[model samples]
Target: ARATVRNARALAQALHDRGFDVLAADLGFTRSHTLAVRVEREGGGESVAQRLAAVGVIANKNLLPGDTSPKHPGGIRIGTPEVTRLGMGEREMVRVAEILDDLLHRGKPPEAVAAEVAELKAGFTTLRYCFAAGEAAYRYYDLVGRDPP
Candidate 1:
């Protein structure tokens, strides 16, 4: 729980530092393992979420304050439990933020960002505290799933 919160806070701060407009700056970004980011400039939550997904970042678009519809949200919610379970810490959170910045703010190509994301994901394929590690976890990158042991 502690680690999850720590990483989530780190991620929120990093995202904010990149001028991403992370929600809840007064509440320390988040107290749990998740945070919300408003992407009004990048075409709202739904569009930005889809762009992030194109580069392999998994996040859900949800309606923010004053937003009327869930289908077209104004914010994207991100969580850190999966990466934290894979042994990611504050440093990796910063890396995640950098990737987001590059894609969202710096105008990097989706293909390039996808390769960078794949590289970052490759480092965490081996999950800690698990006997089967990569085999046990869902292969979210290439969609290659193992049947069973």
Candidate 2:
């Protein structure tokens, strides 16, 4: 609870530091992953993820209708998973936000982005996504007469 309060305060400070217009947060999720950020858009120059990163907040932006990238829309989806995998704590999550922001908004080349993606993946390789495992999980669920696993 103490850590949550601290992080919350830091997030608020960070948003204020970045000049976000509105910065309300969600509290239902057990972790920061559920947080949402809204910033005043400026002539296609400002973006939600950029604001969050300025304040060291990592978040996911939902795809605009029909958009289909891990990042879309104007939302930043952040969580503790990657930090935990990187052997980091809450503070590191804040730092990770910097890396995320740079990659997303800077329009860095795909190869450079892919390399960072690989590092992040290496941190949590267990869920690296395996086709065989997916098929098996699907089969198990199907055996129980469930929808696609």
List TM-score per model, in order. Answer: 0.87, 0.39
**Which candidate wins on TM-score?**
1
Candidate 1 residue lDDT tens string, 39-99: 9888899889989998899999878998888778899999998888888899999999999
Q: Output candidate 1 Cα RMSD.
A: 3.5
Kindly report the root-mean-square deviation of model 2 from the true structure over all alpha carbons: 10.0
- What overall lDDT, based on C-alpha atoms, would model 2 receive against the true structure? 0.42
Off by over 4 Å in 1: 130-136, 139-149
Counting only residues 3 or more apart in sequence or on different chains, how many pairs clash (N, Cα, C under 3 Å) in candidate 1? 0
Error of 1 at 64 (Å): 0.7
Candidate 2's residue-wise lDDT over 30-145, tens digit each?
34423434422421113655544443345555433333443335443344433343334455444444444454445555466556645654443232233443232235566687
lDDT score at residue 119, model 2, on the 0-100 scale? 64
The window of 10 residues in a row where model 1 has the poorest summed lDDT is: 140-149
Model 1 TM-score is: 0.87
